[model samples]
Target chain A: MSEQLATVTGLYGLLAEFREPEQVVAAARAARSAGYRRLDAYSPQPVEGLAEAIGHRTSRVALLVLVGGVVGCLSGFALQYWTMGVAYPINVAGRPLNSWPAWVPVMFELTVLCGALAAVLGMLGLNGLPMPYHPLFHVRRFEAATRNRFFLCIEARDPLFDREATQSFLERQKPLEVYEVPW
Target chain B: MTPPDHVATQAAAHSSVQPPDAPPPVLEPGHTLSTVTDKISSIVLTAPPPRSWYFGLAISFALVMLLMWTITQLLWRGVGIWGINIPVGWGFDIVNFVWWIGIGHAGTLISAILLLLRQTWRTSINRFAEAMTLFAVACAGLYPLLHMGRPWFFYWLIPYPNTMGLWPQFRSPLVWDVFAVSTYASVSLLFWYVGLIPDLATLRDRSRHRLGRKVYGMLAMGWRGSALHWHRYETAYLLLAGLATPLVISVHTVVSFDFAVGQVPGWHTTIFPPYFVAGAIFSGFAMVVTLAVPLRAVYGLQDFITERHLDNMAKIMLATGWIVAYGYAMEAFLSWYSGSPPEEYVLVNRMFGPYRYQYWALLACNIAVPQLMWSRTVRRTGWMLFIVSILINVGMWQERYIIVVTSLHRDFLPSSWGMYHGTKWDWSMFAGTIGLFLALLFVFLRLLPMISIFEMRTLVEEEKHVHGGHSDTSDPRGPAP
Candidate 1:
């Protein structure tokens, strides 16, 4: 396997967003030009063209849910059928070996349960929750993000990241301030 | 290209035109609910509905009182008053009970699950749904106690140390049902109350009378809408949502056990839990549609409870309908394929036997009618959905009847293959429960805020992503007065 190299050293995408959409767009373009592929942007909310500006396309979450849901449904049906029909069949009044009809509701519920669980847990797991520490929390004004701010982060692990060049590049985009994230 | 600062520029432009001393609150940039919410505010948001609303309420209350009277008479007379003969021990009382319980599922699903999912559309309908849940469950819970004949000794259902040395059978599904339903009710109330806290606060601030203010204030839990308070409140709410979601699943599953755990061939199926849950949601959504369509028209929440919300719920109904249909198919296939005569007999009897009309009715309402929802226009239209929802509710009730009375009516004994017919008292009691359910809901509508104000406010903030725009070089200290 080829060893992966981080493009921009130390400095990654901070995505210093403003309330105005134009400001966010302009900064995104400037970061791209500053040779910081690892850079990200932030905003209080979604701007129409923000995804394009950040050079990303689509979320993988839905695919995960679909796969998980299908797997869940199949497994659920198999488990019930295996237990009730094959493993330990209790024949009261000479009922049949495979009572498939009674399994439908449980199968359906399990599918939904699994699908929902996958959607939630997969999201959290992929996002890596309970971090308890992030450099962004150190910023006082960052608290306002929960209220009325939008932001995007391009991790230092991104191929285009560079410490000094990324910082200089972000500075040119007219951001409020760029902070280095230590992960 | 200039990013369209439609709101910001408009605000700035409007500010220049306004008198210098005018308040900034008037010029806030957000697209307030004024247009969307205001169109139907006179109709939807208005409390006490109208004189006509009260007239309906009065009728319902009267009917409920009649039901209570009937109950008193039944209690005085004995279980003999309900015409449940040998084969059909369970009658309208149990059917109505399951029907009401089935109706209750939609409320919890709409309010808790949708809220957790951050579905914005839930805002318009959740309050009403929660009220329906509380009332429907109340109606459902009355049956088993009243069905017991001597209603006074209903506490025997609850496990307690008494003068009698005998303990309640923990192993029995009936005992589990008492815990299940009661726990469901308690947890649902807690979830409902927690969700209402912010709305109650909104009502507290908005109320005209001093007593109203004080009353709502107390219920509002001294909420000031502080960030810290909201944080804790939200954390608790998420936890409760997590708890209630499973409780909702478990309650109906446990209820199914009342039959499934029995030795009856048709009743003893592993599919009871999920099948029961789906049926519960199906009946519950049907009931919601039945009530909401009329209430939406009467209360004037057309825009808020928009066609979109209706369409979504209809889709859900359609989906659950298919699930139930599949359940029926699977049951039939198994009955024949398993080569079990009794199982085959139960399935055959349900379809072509004595109570074949009920089987067809269930199929028509639960399976066939909901197929109409696949059409966008049918689902979006109020009257069409209302009719369908009503039919579905009736069908669901019949489905329970088919499951309980029909199956029990023809036990393993070939000699006792007789049908169970519901007496007039049975029909009257069912009617009475409906009246009771509606009366409670009507009262709830007048008393509580039918919408969550705090949650709505959250949507505005959520619309704006925290990671939104670029501000690369502006110094933190730089500002303008």
Candidate 2:
């Protein structure tokens, strides 16, 4: 593989979106056909076929939750065993060395604590919360994502992300307007 | 091009004042008592009562009052009037406390969790569930206060720096209950308030009387529904929902700590928290169904709280019922597996002991009976569903009693064992609590709009926006466009 450190400057990508979901889908298909890979789409709400247009599988949220729960369960068991059996083992009324029964409540509680913590932290981590900064924020009308606007963006990161080619593809979509993004 | 300009010009020509592009102004024989009553009457007249609604309400109200008077007498005389003795000091009070608290959990789940999930059907039932939660919690909060014997010094439960340099023991489960219940109530109130503001605005816009306008205007908080305001409001509501979802689970988990961390054989277990939470939600749904089934008929909100809503609540009850069943099975399994003689005995007594009837009642109500709802037809039938809900509530209450009273009745030593038989006062006090809960609910029904108007409007708006120009049959989702 020839790892050429290619650098290009003074190149900007423009994004335009159609109000109709079908039009957005058609434009996305056209862009992909036009070899634009580094693209993103935003809608006020989740559109039926937009996930396929963006070319991503199901969200990684479930994976995060699964990993969190497993880790939580393990730590819960480990912590209770360590505290009760090893740390300060007070043999109260001839209870066993590995007293699993006594450990039950704390283990359960810690499991919930860790599982809940994982959900909060995992959600934040996945969503990139407290982000305060994003290139999308630079777009004046991007605030409409929470309201009544649908949008699509083609980043300059894709191998075929040529400024002129991306702009031409978006213009053919016949959206409200096409704007250049300075990332 | 400008609709407002045309309307304004037309109003000027007619010599009648009308705000252009604004909602119609409310005008009538406004401020007088008769006018206000008339306005209320119009809404009431259109309201259709169920065939047997009056009988149900009268009975529930009567029983509730009986419970209240019983409690009042218990509070006045002393905690000694009950049959709780020796090891079984908890008896009916603690059992009732946990029972009521569990009944309160479903309300929060419907409002907060469903809101976060973007479940639109939640709008119809959420308001009544929330009101149920507040009232049930009020009922739940009482048992612990009265159970404390000297209820007046309940202020000491609040953690504070005192003149005598005393601070509450945060480590204790009872202390945790104080914080948990207080925080739950306060947050639940905030959640209810935030959801109500938009509906209040709708009421304000629709009011035709001066008192109606004044009352709703104050509640509406001068909302103009600007895009930015809606944006911020949605964000805030979502954020609050996020906060509340875990809080619901946590509050009940903490409540379970009162039992699970104890040294008692039946009480000490890992499954109690989830078990308790599940049972709470199960009972809560049953209570909501108990209230809403008749309410929709009485209030003429069949379009709002349709059979679909009843079907959903019944499904939820069934789901939670499975959880309760699983928890009970696990407890029995753990007891047998643990190889602890005392734990083994505790499980045995629970199944076939003196209070075996209570145990079977719980199993039948919380687990077996709800299975009938698996058939959609039964769930959709209001009277059938209502009967099941009432039974579930009874079973859940008895389950709590069995857990708290029966377990503690024979603790640590066999010599200290004592069977708890509630006196007449005990029964009356329990009855009194029902009355108090209903009285609060009665006032709430009259004062507030029982159904959420704003959430309904949002659903309508979303429907319109999605199918702007398409044929009704074109939409793939349920009920088409």
Candidate 3:
């Protein structure tokens, strides 16, 4: 069963370690130029131009927040209007049933509330987070990526992925080491 | 590998690119990325609690017990247990409520607003400040519930489905508060949690104990430092900050509305929104300093929470303290200029009324003591700043007491006017919340990475960029167009 599982997951990628962010970035750029599209880089901290080099820049979280905010704003106003104007219309100082002024505070609160919620949830969803398992965790040295090292991984799923060629290509970038990441 | 001296030279050259007026160093000198991770994570992951932590915890837990006793007595007796009367309906309860809520603002300002402004110094303090916001808000939240008289019926504030088919009065600022405070607490929690993720991952990775790793791993949600993940994380964080910025402004404005909407001479003022917001930030920064000064000492976190952090925080307190001073001046000016006999009377009463000492004390602490912060020596001296912070907090509490009690104790109808004096219950509840806040803080320090490891790592990386010509490849998003 374990062997079957390994075959199913197989060798997911060739992971390369670079001593510096510049090295990994240059390697990413080089790989991109070499027409490798299914590549990702990791660094201890954000390295400029690396994301663009590996080509995964745009995020929809902002747009999601906007939608959430609009929904919240409308819902907030609607809730107040439905309750005060329509549902239970009690006269308070002869004020109009549709008291738009009083509704503003709750509306603003909900807008911020929903917008923030969507931002966090959208980020996690887009990143596919809460994912405890990844093929890279199987690599003993991959932990350094969170500490000080830089890494670039070319996934086996890439149409152009040939293990030997990918390994040789990564080696030419003068990376610290290269290893296969097993799923 | 590059020679260590060469790397140093590059970093020194990079420092030149920083604007001459750039703020003081965030992290102490000579910290490598590995060392930074080790130092911060070690506090939670490895080190045993110091004697001070236990001493502080014991005191805090005692206070928590006192708080529980007070609540039990109050619940058994009633709101009569408080010093609040018909004329002074909102006494220490409302005073502490507003004071705590105000103290929460600095955290959001530091974490959300400073992040938006690209102030890197915030990195050092944001984690701590955000945690402060949550705990402070927790303390603030207890007041309105307890003050409701029927604390269990607090759910009536929500517009939930009911057999009577009733809804919370949307027109009331009290109801507005229900939304504002809850939303503020929720968003702050989310913002704090989201910020903790990467740091939690750091802790998860660094923990040698099986239990520590498992706990941190669950909290980290399997973060693997993927660039793609960081990209989305940054965007979400920026969005949350943007959302929270308006919130920090709005929450206090709504809190102010609780008074401003009233017809009382002192309570109804156009300036309340900005005035209250400034006071909130003022008190909140002071509270941050009060917590941070001792915390840095006890934990030996000077390397990360650095002298620069205290200096900058003191400067913030001074700036906001001026704003608060301005608020006082404006309130008095508006009262006199308007020539409303009642407004003029209220202002005069605040100056010479029965609680006149409190008003003066407020000025002494909030306005006068903070003036010392103008001198660089006072701002740089941690103990001096700590003392000033304590004074500011006292002054702020007095400010709220004056606002709530002075305004309510004497209204337009002199016949109904009555003075307020806090009972033991009032002091107990206040002291209890303080204990609860401290106890929660102690636990937080023991478990979480109080200093944001990833952000400090980023700061280190940026510094390296300066020295190494690594700036070119530092931000993939490219230089701002």
Candidate 4:
């Protein structure tokens, strides 16, 4: 129901193309300052501070990694304790059933294993990847986004968006070309 | 392979600039973002592999066949088919395992440690180094599983519940090794895959082949280089690097614990953990040199993997070699300082026993030979470093052999002592694993972008920005279409 306007508009966004990364970044910052929301910028390589310019704050990736590491730590120790001390106790050299020293290596390994997995997987999930079909790919020149060019896209879903106003605004930003992202 | 310095001189001859005293560029100059992407991705996308690649892979594949045959025979017959016997139960199998595992350390050091240290130069070699780590670990893993005698029941090492009411002995260092090694391999893979994603996307986008595009696209997980995605990816990559640093250290330490925890006079050393880790890095860099020299030459990638990279890697090998040499000195010093007759004999017997020649050879190869690296000229000369790296590889293997065989063959009881020798099966198994390692590496080079394309692009941008070269718009390829 909410995307009904977008459906009527028959578009994803207006993409502004630029030769230099600084151009796209500045344009994205300008659009955001002019009260545009739901925008993204793409570049051939990571452009420093571009995400922030496009209305994203600090990413949750690190926090999620921290949570994953904690979960791995607790579970790793729990598995060892339950297996060794509670479930199948083995008395060796008169040591206690719950010998924590012996558990360190496996626990450490699991913490790292689970933590590393979390870092990669969490980043992927947050990014909404495996999205093989994206409207941006429809722009033939958009292929250059992964090569040598940079782009700023202003989605039609933004409240401030108007077909004419947005296109003209993107043009005013001095893009090489402003593309209508036909959905 | 054309010598790297020769390539460097040629590239320099082409450029004909830069003051004499200035440091060599990590990446050769004249690369724009597009140019860097094109050069790297073209290898996977357009450039046909050279004939030498095929010839090398054919040899490696044949060796892989040899490995398969060796494994089949071992499984059919039993542990008895090999020469491992009473005193030297752990011969080529354990020695090769340690050597291969140690060889993986430099990759982790290059990828995770160098990344953390902000070593921008690592960008060119990190991808293949990480891949090398995965393959080396794979090769190392085979020896232990095959040596288990009953390879089919190898799952018994895992700490899972069973009807028989058995659990892995948690206290054993062997059990700890199981956890450590598996964790290291998986983490290394994840790290490698995560690193590869952006480059895979470049391959996907650049690929004209239908099948290649689909395969790379799936692996890339639709990475479109959105600023948001790169932000998350950078964070995740940094976090993984942080976790991998300690994990790499712990892996070798755990491997060393397998010997240190044992009561064998020579094996039970206090310095084993640090010494083993040092030796691991030493051998690992040697292997990296062995791989990198040919890689740059065959692919004409001297522009990316410059002489500076070679010089830096050689410097690291020299530094770690000194650490290993110090470990040898301390180990001998402790032997006499303890005044323990058996411990002292272990050292003396290593020098005077039947295997005394191997001990001196080990010293000469590991200790004396690498001393050539002290010369700046030798370190920069590609072939000399290559020879040194090979010798170090051999010397490190002999160190492990001596540590495992020499100590076990002549234990406390003189009457119980017996000479041990590796049968053909042992040598075949060792050579076979090398084949397996090389075959995996060959396939990786052919299929994937050996250098990270996006990272190289980023490095170019950073270099440009640092020198205020960003506004200069004379791209040889011209503005993107």
TM-score of predicted chain A against the true chain A, for each candidate: 0.72, 0.77, 0.93, 0.95
lDDT of 3 by residue, B201-249 (tens): 8787788999988999899898887778788888899999999999999
* lDDT tens digits, residue span B404-455, model 1: 8778878788898776787777777888887888888777777875655445
Q: What's the residue-level lDDT of B217 in candidate 2?
A: 64
Location of the lowest summed lDDT over 10 successive residues in candidate 2 chain B: B24-33
All candidates' TM-scores?
0.66, 0.66, 0.93, 0.95
How would you encode candidate 4's per-residue C-alpha lDDT over A1-183 as one tens digit per residue? 326667897899899899988898899999999999889999888998899999889888988888888888888789888888888887788888888888889888888888888898899899997788899888888888888889999998888888899999999999999998888
The parts of candidate 3 lying over 4 Å away from their true place are A1-9, B1-23, B469-481
| Candidate 3 lDDT score at position A133 | 84
Candidate with better DockQ, 2 vs 3: 3
What's the DockQ for every one of the candidates?
Answer: 0.02, 0.02, 0.72, 0.83
Whole-model Cα lDDT per candidate?
A: 0.67, 0.69, 0.89, 0.89
Sort all candidates by lDDT, best to worst.
4, 3, 2, 1
Residue ranges of candidate 4 with Cα displaced over 4 Å: B1-21, B469-481
iRMSD, model 2, in Å: 11.3
Candidate 3: residue B327 lDDT (0-100)? 89
2 or 4, greater by TM-score: 4
